[model samples]
Target: MHRSLCLAALLSLAASSALASGFPVTVRSCDRDVTFEAAPKRAVSQDINLTEMMLALDLTGQMAGYSGISGWYKMDDELKARLGDLPELAPQQPTKEVLLGADADFLFAGWNYGMKVGGEVTPDTLEPFGIKVYALTESCIHIMKKDKSSMEDMYTDIVNLGRIFGVEEKALALVDGYKAEIAKAIAAVPADAPVPKVFVYDSGEDKPFTAGRYAMPTALIEAAGGKNIMDDVETSWTTVGWEGVIERNPDVVVIVDYGDVTAEQKADFMRKNPAFKDIPAVKNNRFVVLPYAQATPGPRNVEAVKTLAGAFHPTVN
Candidate 1:
């Protein structure tokens, strides 16, 4: 009995020592290096896209709750089912109070998606509350210089998240699956077919807000054998005059489906407007509506590539 008790005590002591040491993880969030001595006990992610990232890693058990979901867009049944009992802390951008209330030690979000540039709920603001921030790789452009958005950016986020949460194997597997699926989808496209010119119409009537060269949709369009007509915009999502749309005369117009305005309404506006009458897409009535979840950078991007590939190359599959 004495020996058994001593063994238990020694094992307990060793575990206590290991716990004290913790797992020191260092990852690059934007231009800065943020390190965590241990995996966060409670994490909060903003926006459906970022939330989906965490869900992909099966990290709901590590999360306190999610924010910035139902307020902007309807939470789909699949996401709701996945969430199960996980609560929505805030319908929109979660404040410091919400984070503190839930005792969230980490936040997985990006600029504009949740924490704005120099906004109230930025990394600096949350630092005082002991909440570490992991900025989305694609949104790094908002703060620092970055090469245009690519599949690699999303993959980097997944890999880093896995590292942070001790799920590197799952992350690597997911990324590999994405890479294989994407390559297969792209390979099936006809080499002889002309690449379609795709105009991403996110929203706006007077001046159309569209995806630019640095946006994930640009990469999505490229992968699907199409070109973003506004690839020269120099920024991610931005506003450009209708004159440019008319000037470009894209072969297909992709509508971003979200917010108060329906995709059909946005399409109707373009179709009825005199300014867009001569536009090739308008004349040809070739408009594809992509859901907000799929259009943005996330795991859904892989499925989006397949969808866009089908639209861009009707002859293939």
Candidate 2:
């Protein structure tokens, strides 16, 4: 009995040591390096995308509070169940005071969305408080002169957060699962199907706001076997004249479904407008509606790809 007890104690110690081996994770963001000495016991999510990511990793228990644009799109039921009444730090971006009061050691947010450059609650401001901020990889280029965005950015952010929270295995599995789902979706597209020219309509009736080359929507379009007509623009989101849309005359238009305006209203507006009437998509009603959440850089990107693929190629089983 003495020998058995000693062996059990040794096995327990070995398990604890193995778990401790994952700590001291270091990841770079923009131009700065953020290191996690150990899993953060308290964290704040500044964006709904980040909130969903935390839920995906089963780290909701570590979340102290969350803030950002809510009600843009309804979260999945599973996510809603997991989220369950977490305190709201702010309706939009939390002020420095709110952040401080939360006493969180970690913050997950986008560039401009969370802590804007030279803003009140920057990484510099938070650093003095012993807090580490991880900027969304897609927004890094716009804020930090980093490389252009890619789907990999989202995957890397997810994995990095996983490492910080000591959920490396879960994060890797999530990445692999998303990759497989995307591959399966893309493979369903017919090889010989004509790629549709897609126009992303993000609102703004007067000037017309749309996604550009650096946006995640562009990457989703490419993955869906479609071409973003505005991919020529060298920025993320930009305004273009209706003349540009008329010039391209894309085969399909993707209406971003978000706050206030409904997808049907956007379609109707296009149908009634004389300038867009001549467009092939407007004429044939080839408009695809994508939720605002899925269109952004996050876990839903693969779902966005699958959605676009189905709309682009109806022949795909």
Candidate 3:
């Protein structure tokens, strides 16, 4: 019996050793192969979504510093408290110099959020510094393939981050929790209920920018028992004329809350516009507000779906 116990202990130790040495994780990002030698000790995250992702994973201790629109609006109290002490590298998007100066081994940022067009910093540019940059799965499509962005993309990202950090179990648990929450939100909707026609108001008045099929908001709308009127748009976010919006006449208007303009301001603009006054959502005042961070692919997506579902199907008490 003692021998058997020793054998079992040896096996457990071997398994733990294998997990620790399971490094050199490689993931495809923006059509390029990114390989990590080991779990990053110091990581600099960009954008509120990515930063929150690190916090949600209980990896805040791995963070060196963060620079993004974290303060754009209010985040959940727990997330805010978790991030309250992290050093700020920048308030908004940081330049390549600023990012490099953070002395981080990894950078978690999506397309256009950290690496911009004609910018000084990029995956290729940072490779020489021994830094590995992982692009958020949702934005990677813009630079590579044509896969329509979905919640699966977000899940895949979480899994990848988990692998890179050597925290596969934690990542899997987070994904499972999110999946259950999303399933619950989906189950709340009755099969016989008709899907509401929904229009997403992101920004722009004359052009009326809205989320396309490639954006996460499209998926959130669908899960919420509503169909995006602009789901036909192949791009992530696009501009549509007022005539186009008036033509569809969405039953609910989901305002993307971000930038200088508040959600209330955006709704007020729509209500006051003579051309928009006759629209169903405008006339009925059926406006649902979602934070810009939630609209993006991130941890708050489950909350975003729940919020929109409540608005789309109010009867589902």
Quote the positional error of residue 193 for candidate 1 in Å.
1.9
lDDT value for model 1: 0.90
* Model 1 error, position 71 (Å): 0.8
Clashes of each: 0, 0, 0
Q: Among all windows of ten consecutive residues in candidate 1, which has the lowest summed lDDT?
A: 16-25
Write one digit per residue (lDDT tens) for candidate 3, span 1-317: 69999999998897777656786678777677778777898899888888878887888888888887645553456766778788878777777677678887888887767776456767777788877889887776567666776788889888888988888789999999999998998898888888889999999877888888788888888877889998888777778887888899899999988887889999999999898888889899999998877988889999998998888888775
Clashing residue pairs for model 3: none
Candidate 1 per-residue lDDT over residues 1-317, each given as its tens digit: 69999999998997787566545778999988999878888999999999999999999999999999899875889889999999999999998899999999999999888888878899999999899999998888888889987889899999999989878789999999999999999999988889889999999987989998788899999999999999988888889998888888899999999888999999999999988888888899999888898888799999999999998888887
Output the worst ten-in-a-row residue range by lDDT, candidate 2. 69-78
- In model 2, the runs with Cα more than 4 Å from the true position are 1-19, 71-79, 146-148
Is 1 or 2 the stronger prediction by TM-score? Answer: 1
Top candidate on lDDT is 1
Show the lowest summed lDDT stretch of 10 residues, model 3. Answer: 70-79
How does residue 78 of candidate 2 score in lDDT? 69
Model 2, position 186: C-alpha lDDT score: 91
Task: Please identify model 1 stretches exceeding 4 Å from their true place.
Answer: 1-22
Clashing pairs in 1: none
Alpha-carbon error at 229 in model 1, in Å? Answer: 1.0
